[model samples]
Target chain A: MKRNAAAFGAGALFAVGLALSGMTRPAKVVGFLDLAGDWDASLAFVMMGAIAVHFVAYRVVLRRPAPLFDVRFHLPTRKDIDLRLVLGAALFGVGWGLGGYCPGPGLVSAAAGSLGAIVFVVGLTAGMLIEQAVARALPRRE
Target chain B: MHDFTPIPALIGGAIIGLAASLLLLTHGKVAGISGLYGSLLRQGTSDRAFRLWFIAGLAAMGMLVRLTWPAAFASAWSASLPVTLLAGLIVGFGTQLGNGCTSGHGVCGLSRLSVRSLVATLTFMGTGFATVFVVRHLLGGAR
Candidate 1:
């Protein structure tokens, strides 16, 4: 219960940051990407601020032997660089550039009930289902 | 330059970082939206409870933001249906395929100084910039 509570609060806080930062707006995202055009450099500041705070917070939290509820931290430990990582990120980049909605803002926008955002989410889930099928065929790495 | 908004961007980013920190401190879970949302479609997962609650909270706040700040979604992107759908499908597939997205790889992963996250971040950011350049400059602006 406590863990779920924390997760809920964190998720809400995450939304607050996204909205306040104007990340929920995709045009800002596209503007940030348009280097040759009138570039909106706000995304850089968002990243810089997020990283600066998380840099300190991450180290401080890991000081504990275990997380508050979990027995251990479930950090990603994979070190191998395979074809999947690069290709996947590239594909995601294309999608992001085209749509201006990554997972976080995509979901939020969808929840706010825009037909386009909803359609994007539908396509996204279908894509996930397809990827799941493909992944199942490959040998498990982790 | 005129579009530069360092104030809200920084303040909002710090909030996001704090939220990520809260999730990590309590649940040891990386605050990646793709992973959290993907977990819904996943099976044999014991941690599904928190993921659902997380998304629920996100949705609730989404509506709240709409109420409190209507202007946030006012200038929403108006991509064609095909483009929006294609983007969605590709994003979902790619994030799952890559094992992370902006929040996972961009925020949490980088904070940990993981070399792999660094590589993934660069790959996505590079392609993102390239795609935008082609669409806006060569093809005459996507939206």
Candidate 2:
């Protein structure tokens, strides 16, 4: 129960941050994307600040043997560059440039009752479902 | 135009950073939206409750903020639903294929100094640049 509460609290705080940061506003995102127009550099600062905090945070967490939740830090071990990574990045970029909302903000915006957000979430879930189906149908390579 | 100063951007960024850090400290989980959502689909009854509550809290936070600061809601880019849906599908597929989203790889994964994340981030970012180039410049979808 406590863990659940903690998760919910974290999610709520994340949502508030997204709203306060103007991430919920698609125009701001589009402006940032618009290199030729009056560009908005706010997202860059947001990314920088986020990176700075994470740098320090990880240093501290790494000092500890394990995390508070009793699990090893679930960092990815794979290092190879492959088609899946490149293709995924391309698709994400195309979607973001066109819609001006990524998954995090899209989910939060949908919660805020934005019709665009709702559509985005639906499509996102459908995509996930399709991926799962394809993965299931494919023969195991290992 | 959206009026904002460097101060708010910095402050907002810091707050987001702090929140993300705290989440990591407490739950030992990166604030990755895709992983969080994916967990809900894969995990069983024991997991469903927490994920559901977490997602619900995200929605409630938006409502609370909307009630407190109505001005933030004002924006001109209420795009058509179909466009948004298509965009979402692409992002979903991309994240699944890439193994992370912006928050996951861009913020958290990069912080860990993961080379794969670095490559993924660059790819996503570069693709974003190209996409805007095609959409607004070549395609001429101004504003």
Candidate 3:
């Protein structure tokens, strides 16, 4: 229960941040990306602020031998610059430019009952499910 | 730069960072939305509870925003239905295939100074800029 509570609290804070940053709106996001046109540089500030804080805070948190609730950190250890990563990111970028909604803000916007956000989430879920199904059906290389 | 709001963006971003920090300090977890959301779709996972609660909290905050700040929720992107649907589908597939999205790779992964995330972030941003340019400038914007 406590762990869940912590998760909930963190999620709430994150959502609030997104909202306050004006990132909950697709227009703002797309505007940020539209550098050639009338670009909105607010999102850059958002990224800078987040990176600055997390950059400092992560080191502070890691100094502790263990987290309060877990035995070890669950960090990603992959260091590959493979084709899949590039292709996936390129696809994601197109989607982001097309819809102006990433996973976090998409869910948040969907919660707010935006029709566009709903459509985006549906497509996103379908894509994820399809990938899972295909991966399951295929043979493993490793 | 008519709507270039730096202060609020910075504040909100700091809050997001704080949230990420809290999750790490307490749960030893990365607050990547796609990773958390993806796990919920899977079955027989003991860690499902936290993810569910986290998502629920995100939704609840949206509700709160809707009730309090409706203008903040307003959007400017007015693409057609088919276009929006396709975009969503592509985004979903891309994030999953890549194993992360803006939050996972852009925020959390980059902060950890992961080389893979750096490449992913750059690739996505480059493509995003190009797509927007093509859609808005070359194609004369969305309908």
TM-score of chain A of each: 0.95, 0.92, 0.95
Ranking by lDDT: 1, 3, 2
Off by over 4 Å in 2: A140-142, B1-5, B43-49
- Looking at chain B only, the TM-scores across the models are 0.94, 0.83, 0.94
Residue-level lDDT of model 3, residues A11-81, one tens digit each, is 99999999998888889999999999998999988888888899899999999999988898888888877
TM-score of 1: 0.96
CA lDDT of A90 in candidate 3?
Answer: 92
lDDT of 2 by residue, B29-137 (tens): 6777776775665525244665676677778887787778754545675556787788888888788777788788887888888888888888888888777778778
Show what share of the native A-B interface contacts model 3 retains.
Answer: 0.80
Please give the TM-score of chain B in predicted model 2: 0.83
DockQ by candidate, in order: 0.81, 0.66, 0.83
Cα lDDT, model 1, residue A45? 86
Per-residue lDDT, model 2, residue A51, is 82
lDDT of 1: 0.87
Task: Please give the ranking of all candidate structures by TM-score, highest first, separated by commas.
Answer: 3, 1, 2
Q: lDDT of each model, Cα atoms only?
A: 0.87, 0.74, 0.87
Alpha carbon lDDT at A66, candidate 1: 96
lDDT of 1 by residue, A1-142 (tens): 8888888899999988888887888788888888888889999888888889998999999999999999999999899888899999899999988888888888887887756778889988998888988888887776
